[model samples]
Target: MEKIVISESNYQIRKARIVRTKKLTPLETLFEIVLDGDRSLDHEPGQFIMVSLFGIGEAPISVASSPTMRDSFEICVRAVGRVTKALHALDAGDEIGIRGPYGKGFPIRIFEGNDLLIVAGGLGIAPLRSLIQYVLDNRRDFGKAHLLLGCKTPQDILFADELDQWRRRMDVQSEYIVDRAEQDWTGPVGLITTLIPGVHLEPERTFGVVVGPPVMYKFVIKELLAKNIPEHQIILSFERHMKCGMGKCGRCQIQNIYTCQDGPVFRYSAVKHMSEAF
Candidate 1:
C-alpha cells in the first residue's frame, strides 16, 4: 500500500514567526509560533508539523498548542541533535519554515463526550498539552478528565502557568509526580503509573491517552489495564527519529507503521500486537 500525502508539494512555511521561546529545562525549548499569515494551524490535537531549518535539516514536531486556538500553534523541541539545537538558538520574531499539521492527533471528537485519562511523562506532556488544553477550552464537551504528569524533578515541569490553571479548574483533576524532589518541592514522588490507581473512572467510557519515552508505556499501560481500561480504549503517541514530515523519509518507521505517517497517535488495540510500538 502507498501513503496518503497530506500536502501535495509540501506546504510552504508561509512566514511563521516565533512569538516566544522559553528554555524549560536543560534539554527542552518551548516555541510559541504563529503562521506568518496568522492562519489557523488547522491541526487535530495530536498531529505534528514538519519544521525546516534551511541549509540544516527538517524534523517532525508535534503541534503543542490546542486546535481550539485557531491563530497560532506551538511545538516543544528537545535539543538532542543539530537542528533542534539550532531551533533553540532562535528568538522571538525570528522566522522559521513549517509544513503540515500532519498525521493523527488524539481522537478528540471520538473521546468528546467520554471521560479521558491523560498520562504524560517527561517531554511527553508536550503533545498531550494540546488535548489537555482543548478539553479545558471546551469543558462541557467531555466527561470527567484526569491528568497524570511525571517528570525528573520539580524544576522539570512544563507549562507551569497552564498546569496551575488546570489545577484550579473544577471539571478536571490534575496530579503532578516527580522522580525525586528537593525540600522546596511537595508533590507525589514516584513514577506516573502510581497516580492511575487513585483516579475514579469507568474504564469502558474512558480513553487513556499515554505519551512518554518509549520505555515508559509498558509499565504505564499495564497499570491502566489492571484498573480495567479496555485495551482499545488506551490511546498512545510515540516518539521517534523523524526525518521527513512526509512518509517518504522512512526514518519514523515502526514495523509496518510509520510513526510519522500512520501515527504519532494510535489506539492501543491497534498496536498492542506490535511490540515495536511503545
Candidate 2:
C-alpha cells in the first residue's frame, strides 16, 4: 500500500491521480482518485474537497466514496462548467489538483445508535453516498437504516448497482422514486416526499439527513416534521455556490454563516430562520 503523511497547509494542492472512471450518464462521470504517495483524504462522511484543474481553476466536489475505503476516494462530477467539463475529459491515470476535505460533514457520531432516515434527491445522492457507504460498512452500529431517493428520470439514478444492493440488503430498508419513468423502470414513481408517509420510524429515535435541490428541502422537511422528528434531528446538506474552500470568499455565505466552513451540512434548526438557506 502507498503511504503519505497528510498535509496541514490549507493552500497546498496535492496531486491526485484518477485510478478509475465510469461514465454514469452523458453529463456525469464518476472518478475514483488517490493522492500521490497514497495519502488518505481522511474526511468525514459529508465533507467536500476542492478539485483543481490547474489553469482551469477549482471547484468544490463532495467526497462521494466513504472514508471506510481507505485506499482511495471518489467524486461524481457533472459537466456543467469549465473546470468540470475539463474534469470530464480526463481519462484514467490523469492527474488533477486537490485541496481540503473542507467544511463540517454529516454528524455520523451523533447518529450512532439512532435510527437513520436518509433522503437524497437527484445529484444530492452524490454526497449522501458517502454516508450510506459508511453506515453499511458499520451496519451494526445503528438501529435501522432507511434510504429514500428520487431523481428526474430512470437514467438519472446515480448508483444503480449499489442502490440495488441496499434495497436487497436485509439491513437497509430502501425505496426509490423518480418523477418520470422510462418504460423499463419498475420502481416507485412520484416525489421523494411520497415515500416518507409509509416509512416505519420512531420519530424521537430517528435522525433524518436530507440532501437535495432547494425546492426539495421545504417539502421533505415538512414531511419529516410531520413524522415528528425533532428540528435538530433533521439534518441537511446544502449545495451552494462555494468558492474558496476557506471562509474568506463570500460566495457561499448565507446570512452570517459560510457554507464552505460553518457548513454545507447543518441541523435544520440552525438554518430554519436563514432566508438564504432555503
Candidate 3:
C-alpha cells in the first residue's frame, strides 16, 4: 500500500495574542488581537473566525475590524455561554487559538459605486461594523451611505464614541433608535424598523445590508422591500451555531445549505425561500 500523508489540517489553529481589551457593555467585551508573526487576519467584512481556548472549546465570532486594519483585528464578545464567558475572563496579554476568517463575506465589488443603506440591530452591529468601516476608509468608492442602528437602550449601544464620530461625518448619514429609554433619553424610541421609512435613496442604485437578531430580519426586509430595493440587492447575515468553520460540521446547516460555507452572508433572493434562514 502507498502512504499518503497530510501536511496540515484545515482545523489548524494559529496562535494569537490579545493586545488590548475594552468592556463595551456589561455583557460584551471587545478584544483586540494580533496573529503571531505580524500576520494580518486579511478578512473581508462580514466574515467570521473560530476562536478557541484549549480547555474551554471554540466559538465563531465575526471580525469586528475591517481589512484596512492590517496589523490587528477585533472581536466583540458577549459573555453568553461557556466559551464566551471564558473568553471574557481573559485580558490583554492572554493567548488564544484562531482557526479561520471563514465563510463568504459581503460582496464588496458589487457594492462599489452604489448608494448604501446599512441597518444594524443590537449585537448585529459587531459584524456590520466591518463593512461600515471599510466603506468609510474607501469612501470614494461608494455613494451616499446611510446607517440606521437600533439597540435595547442607550447603554447597550456598542462603539458609542465611534458611532458619534460616524454621525458627525458629513459623508455618512446616521440615525439611532432604542426599543426603550430612561427618563433622560431624548432620542427616538421605537423598534429599528421605525427609522427605515424616512431614509431617502435611489432604490435602484442602493444596496441594503442588514444584520441583527433573527426576529429583526423579516420586519427589516419588509421595510427595505417597501423602499423598492431589489431582492438581490438586499443582503443579510444569518446567525447560526457554526461548530466548524468548514461545511462538513453540519452544525451551521440550513437544510442543504451551510451557513458557514454558503453564507453567514446571503442575498435575500437567494435565501427568501429557505424557511430555516431567517
TM-score of each: 0.95, 0.96, 0.96
TM-score of candidate 3 relative to the true fold: 0.96
| Candidate 3 C-alpha lDDT tens digits along 1-278 | 11122125436899999999999999999999999888998889999999999998999999999999999999998999999999998989999999887888999999999999999999999999999999999999999999999999999999999999999999999999999999898899999999998998999999999999999999999999999999999999998987877777698888778888888899999999987786
lDDT sort, best first: 3, 2, 1
lDDT, residue 44, candidate 1: 88
Name the 10 consecutive residues with the lowest summed lDDT in model 2.
1-10
Please, what are the lDDT tens digits per residue for candidate 1 over residues 1-278?
24656666355655588999888778888898988768788888888888888888887788888888887788999997878889998999898888887787788779989999999998889889988888888999999999999998988888888899999988889999999998888787988888888988898999999999888999999999998999989999987888776678788887888887788888999889888675
Provide the lDDT at 197 for model 3. Answer: 89
TM-score of 2: 0.96
TM-score of 1: 0.95
How big is the RMSD of model 2? Answer: 4.1
Compare candidates 1 and 3 on TM-score and give the better one. Answer: 3
